[model samples]
Target: MRIWVVLAASALGLAGASRVAAQRALGKLLFFEPALSVNGKRSCASCHRPEKAFTDHRGTPRALRFAGNLRRNSPTILNAAGQTSFFHDGRASSLDAVIEAVLTSPDEFGSSYAQAAQRLGSSAEYRQLFRRAFAAPVAANTINAALVAYLRAQTATASPYDRARAGGPALPATPAAGAALFAGAGGCAGCHGGPQFRDGQRHEVAAGQWVKTPTLRNVAVTMPYRADGGAATLAAVLTDGYHRPLPPRPLTAPEVEQLTAFLEALTDTTSADHRAPAALPRMRDLPGRAVGGQY
Candidate 1:
């Protein structure tokens, strides 16, 4: 009887694991699905390309149906799970709210939840996946939950700096020296603190404008820097002298190099799941290279 009970518990644990995996897989397909958009050409991956550190490599992603272009740069969604607020200006209080805004924004997905549901629900493949993942019909809540799961799974925290912090191994020479400067002279830890390297609060960068401090997990690839993408390079971000609570003093040339090395050492995207599904559920016009959409 005890053996049977142990086996039952093991089976339940396996079932739970299977459900989590199914949810992440379903979310990946939905993430790459363009049919949810009014134009049927854009998806979350369009702006957050996996190979590009989950950023579109644009200062600001171009707005389709809306007037001109998006105001802020396309911040990387990698390591973005626990941010206190979403978006550059901290407009959305939750990740689900961010998804809702983007889905309805005239410039973005440019559609409504009802339309998106209708399109996705038409796909038998999507329906099956949703059922397996959530044991429920595809709808706003389930879709959002799957998306949240996938987005939260994109964390990349195995960097050399993190390893050093964990007492596993020390960082390389240059990065080690730079780490000292980061906390001391650089004063970066004042805002970019904690394990995620962010304080999750908006800070005044310009006279009247304040933007949330973004994580430095993959800052090497998610340039041009700043909320507006004004700084073209990491070096520029250090020398621009635009941010408030500036470093104790101007960083010298060697110090700048040291800080840059330290920042680069924070990158650890090797573990992120960058695979795209073989095909979307009911996507009609799958492009030759449509994994991340046209953009």
Candidate 2:
């Protein structure tokens, strides 16, 4: 009788937890909303455009409106959820931390939590959504939770490589050789390995680069190779190993060919799924607290 009661209670707790999670969709909706930008125009999509493999469309080292040398090239959102930390500096630990940090970044959203929050709370739409998603509505913590859920939702659909190895086309000779070279001499797979192609580990590659080592998942579409735009093409990035103002790697010309082939294979090559998102959220600012809900 005691065991049965305990099991029933456990199931009830899980059911409540799921309901709370469902209410969290508000945060994800806000992520792509341009209203979050200080200019009332630049959304997360401004830098991490979904259509372009979730990166800056222009592929500029520094964004058009940003200050000189935008910290690092805006990274791809491809498989970012799998990343251990956010940014080339590995500064943020989770999606919420990064979202809040960027929302107040003078270079990015440049808005305060109180100001943004009030903007959100004032809206009937935001209020109702928050109430539905939260135990109540318009709380700072609740807002943050919503945004975190939104970011975590940004997932990449399976690519050709996913299909190929899962029982379709065999890796062509060049890419096969490249894969071996990557796991072997070229050491391409040293940092980029496994299905998603990134260990989510930062390496001291000690090359003229410093980044959290982005994934090769969609290398074909996410270009302007290198965080600082040191390499213009994948081939240059692979063989020359993306440069720094200082120096580059020791990769040779033949190595570039093999590596490029491997990277090219990382592209989906046939998926048209990068369409606009469904149900664009209504974004108004959030209210209460200062520093734009600094997390």
Candidate number achieving the greatest TM-score relative to the actual structure:
1
Candidate 2 lDDT by residue in tens digits, 2-43: 332343234336557564455435654565555565655556
| Stretches of candidate 2 exceeding 4 Å from the true structure | 1-25, 59-69, 205-209, 241-254, 269-273, 277-295
RMSD of every candidate to native, in Å, equals: 5.8, 7.2
List TM-score per model, in order. 0.90, 0.76
Q: What is the lDDT of residue 48 in candidate 2?
A: 70
Write candidate 1's Cα lDDT for 16-123 as tens digits: 878778877888887888876787778898888888888888888878654578888999988888877999889888878888899899888889988888777877
Q: Please give the range of 10 consecutive residues that has the lowest summed lDDT in model 1.
A: 1-10
The C-alpha stretches of model 1 lying farther than 4 A from their native spots are: 1-14, 65-67, 283-289
lDDT of each: 0.80, 0.62
